[model samples]
Target: MRTIVQQGTRCTALAGYVRPDTLDSALAARAKGLRVAAGCTDLFAAVRGPALSGGILDITAIPELRAISETPEHWRLGATATWSDIRLAPLPPAFDGLKAAARELGAAQVQNAGTLGGNLVNASPAADGAPCLLTLEAEVELASRRGTRRLALGDFLTGPRQTALAEDELLTAVLVPKSAAAGHGAFLKLGARRFLVISIAMAAARLDLDGGRVRHAALAVGACSATARRLPAAEAALAGARADAGLAAAITADLVVPGLSPIDDLRASADYRAAAAVTLLRRAVAGLCTGREAAA
Candidate 1:
């Protein structure tokens, strides 16, 4: 709870918190098993008591970890980049779904302070970022004193509240290949209510057209399984189909329902969640194709 500012950089040091302004310093601290923190929107909510269990390594002061930039082959979202950063970045249409997800995360304050890396680390079953990142085929970059490595977004989220992140590693950034950045994308979420509501079902979709026929499609649904999933069968069914208002017709229950294993929860029943997934996917398809993003 105390900050020391030196040469325009910040380093917070307190009873149980330390924020280092450089990657090397952060990694050295990370090696000691300090909890990694960014934004900490979920951390405070998840902690049952007034204070965190142990020491915290706050990475927000690390300059390199808060940037949003593009390289020739990919767009990099630094792990500390806020939801507002992603929503306002000069990204292509393929990021529309992600931007929409940002807007839907919470009210303005949460959008301003919540970090993308924190979302991945929390690994919530209903995380709004997962489905969108899955559609983009994003990869998370992890760094530790040992070295840095990357994992495909889908592979990183093992299950609800579980991930492939290592104890000694810091999630440095998320990489989106320029190859998947060519098409338009959209997102849809069905919540009990609008503001601050956990999704019962959500879907993210991206589509590329070739000569007025569907050349590529990426469809993913979340809050309907242990982890968000790509609807490959449904995507395959849409291949060569016309890209128009009727694009949603290709979606069928069997194609969309085969892989999900939702359980009955306080928010919604398993059957309702499964059925909502199909509707959300279809609407996401129509939203991306028609340029009128819709929500349910």
Candidate 2:
């Protein structure tokens, strides 16, 4: 452990930098109050005003924390897997929504350096990746010197900028079950403008069709609540519905409106956000249906 003094005009905060090449070492460093840093995309920006207090535990060098792998039952994305890596990985169709979200996360520079674990840990209400991951029914893996634990993505995110991560635990990976990975997916984001803008509202949809009817539906909306939430009512309505434009008709505002708790922000009004979330969800599901049609 190397102690470094961050010099600031107003105040200086002492931070220790530790580059751990192994998972055990990284866990031990985190146990000692060192802030975890993988991509540093968010960490550096956050500490720009205030000097870093506790040192940083850099886990990017750990090979075990950087590999993406698949098992018979699930796909495991390592903590250090960057957005760019996810966008380029050879994943199933169910990950299409996630890949689309990955492409729109900031710019090429940010995506190249921003890791999936960092995005989830940030736990922003408007995070582009959260809606897609929520719809995919992803689970987060947390590890400490004590042992490892898994939490559903919904349970892992408690509120805006908050998560279930313990001080001594490190988010090791994200797991997507095979059942959730067996569908066609689509993502739609509503922003003030086109490129490099935060979402006013965004939706991700995954649909599994059997005999031209919807057998399974997963839909989630973001930027409209303290945390992104799945629309269970709308998903239930879509069951057995024709997997075509007619599927959009089953997704009424009433079904999704109840699940959203939008707040008035500078970017948009609460009512506007609610409306946009409903529209985005309909479009996302429609897009999935259209893509399936095209493929057929």
- The sequence of per-residue lDDT tens digits that candidate 1 reaches over residues 30-64 is 99988888998888777745456568899999878
Those runs of model 2 whose alpha carbons end farther than 4 Å from true positions after fitting are: 1-15, 49-51
Q: Please report, as a residue range, the 10-residue window in candidate 2 with the lowest summed lDDT.
A: 1-10
lDDT of 2 by residue, 59-137 (tens): 7777767677888788888888888888988888999999999988888999988989999999889988889998889
| Cα displacement (Å) at residue 107, model 2 | 0.8
Backbone clashes (count) for model 1: 0
lDDT of 1: 0.87
Give the Cα error of residue 287 in candidate 2, in Å.
1.0
Instruction: Count residue pairs with overlapping backbones in model 2.
Output: 1
lDDT of each: 0.87, 0.86
